[model samples]
Target: MSTAAAHPAVRTRSLGDRRRRTLAWVGVSLLVVLGVFVAGGVAGDAASTTALADRNLGPSAGHPFGTDPLGRDLLARVLAGLRLSLVVGTTAALVSAVIALVLASAAAVFGGVVDRVVSWLVDLFLALPHLVLLILLAFVFGGGTQAAVLAVALTHWPTLTRVLRGRAREIVTSDHVTVSRQLGHGRGWIARHHLAGHLTGHFLVGAVLLFPHAILHEAALSFLGLGVDPGEPSIGVLLAESMRYLSAGAWWLAVLPGLCLLVVVKLVDTIGENTRALLDPRSAHL
Candidate 1:
């Protein structure tokens, strides 16, 4: 049938399908960009070497992203930094999601006092400023990769835990869950077979959505000298070091790295939104 002549539901489904396809293509393009950065980081060794003679050069065939004041290739440094940021962000998000799953599941399966305590903790964390809390945690851990990861992981969990807890509560009241309970199925059995299995998609989407936040926070921490070591090639560190050279009119030093970070964050966010929509049943007719 012609699109205009089709039923409203059919048209809606078609539109949603097209949107999902477009989003899938965009996600693939983003992945390709990320892969290129990873490959460049692996292939480029010029980031570590300082060529004083070539310092502060603008973009060219020889130095596409130009050279920093320290004479390190900006392109290479950006790629390396991008890779590190992605690694740290993904690791932290995954850790956060896992913690959320465990705590949320426990609260749902073992209700009453446990649920109240978990819910209270979630509310408390949600009320606190994430960045400030993250910085404090990072500082306590002495400000390195471990500190950044831990801070991001710990700080990001409360929101996702609340979501999972709500879903778990709904599942607990389902007829199959009631039947399973009557059949002598323990909480552990229902959790493993029903709750965990059903909640996997939510967990995955939550983790993906958390990635950009983790990356930005990691970069912010590093920029403030509370994240990665100064010697490490991270996007935040590169931007932090670039401040001194910007006054000398070497704009590429800061601009390029900043753009790269922005692109990565935007792509991750887009992918997360797309994934969430795809997983959501309501979006089927959008």
Candidate 2:
């Protein structure tokens, strides 16, 4: 082939390779996260088991993440924390996504009053300081796992709602959707068959993207004593408890677990980004 023809083939191959790598990274990141979630659950009791003899041990072959002041295995504790974080984050994200979906759908389909209300609500939420709003809601809800989930869910929906509303509005105006409306389809039927079907990609991508934020917020709430139960070794709780010991040179107490949390968050965020790229027709081929 001529150089020009060969250049196109090479570019196509490069794009294909890049796409595959992105998909692979997404899959691997997901598996690692899922593994941590499941492993932590399996090691539930071990995370809290105190071992006076092993107290404050640094990273060793047997205790890779070291031991906490209370002599609990740090790795086990971190795993448990991650599991709890995952549960809280996933629940909150799903709830937030559902809220977004419902409000966006209403705004797009009903328009006028409903649209105005949604727009106002989204603006109000966006205007608030996110973390402050979270803390306030969490405090009001009595500061527990449920509170954390609810607060995160309530606070995170506005952005997604706005995005989905725009998409939903476009979908509502599409030929098929208009035809459905003209064919005697009820609002509910049209929503389910047309809007919902079309908006699935946006819904999923938004939910996935919301997860890391949920996890971090949950951790922050716990750190502030407004998150999971005090006794649970959630990442935030672990970090909270490690504060006193940090001055004593046991850096692993806070650093290691915090790093793990960051890693998980990064992984989840990567998965979300890659998934979004794959789903987006604009970028999927590039």
Candidate 3:
């Protein structure tokens, strides 16, 4: 290679090209998510419409994912399920993230008694039986979309809280924070200006990573008949309904929808991981 091309700045410029490509991939993934949401929304009513005469069909040109025993189009139903999962997961993840951020910030900023209380709460939540807790919460809330969202939201925050708390504590003890305090800023002022601002990226990345877990939990509750109403063709509901027919040798009823769910989850996970990588100074070069 030429001396100019071998220069450190030139190598860094090539790395920038890789970073741009990573960004492009993220954009494409987001577009795919948007397309699924839109398609599902468009198929909302059709997802519930049934034609018994056309029931139990396998994949074909007309119905790409085939038809359920109720003869509702599986493709449409899966799309609708995905759309619903996206909504529930996104809402739950955001709520959970906020809860984590607040508790972590409080624990870090106010230390002593406040820190102890937050630590106790985080430990208590972390020690519980996660799936059982989800079921209990969903059951308590009367088992529907709202219940499922609440159950997932409430259960997923502890781990993230612990992570953010450590980061927040580091920030709190930093020279900049010390300087702000010496300038006569109150705890609230320092937290609002210094702590909150620095932690925004971490908060966002945590929320995105939490999304797949939220989606899966929502589906699990739905599969157990405590999620979205049975009238809604959620992936869980579809899988639940497919159980009986699998014995009758209707394999597509479960396989295709399940695969679709897996794919969507994996795609969201990829987005989160890449976003984190790009945001982390240590990983930005990769």
Off by over 4 Å in 3: 1-7, 283-286
List of clashing residue pairs for candidate 2: none
Q: lDDT: which candidate is best?
A: 2
TM-score (all chains, Cα) for each model:
0.92, 0.95, 0.95
Better of 1 and 3 by lDDT: 3
| lDDT (tens digit, per residue) of candidate 1 on 63-148 | 99999887888898888888888889999999999999999999999999999999999999999988899999999999999899
lDDT of 2 by residue, 37-141 (tens): 899999899998999998999999999999998899999999999999999999999999999999999999899999999999999999999999999999999
Ranking by lDDT: 2, 3, 1
Residue pairs whose backbone atoms clash in candidate 3? none
- Model-by-model lDDT, in order? 0.89, 0.94, 0.93
Model 1 bad stretches (over 4 Å):
1-5, 8-16, 19-23, 281-286
Please report how far candidate 3 places residue 70 from its true position, in Å. 1.5
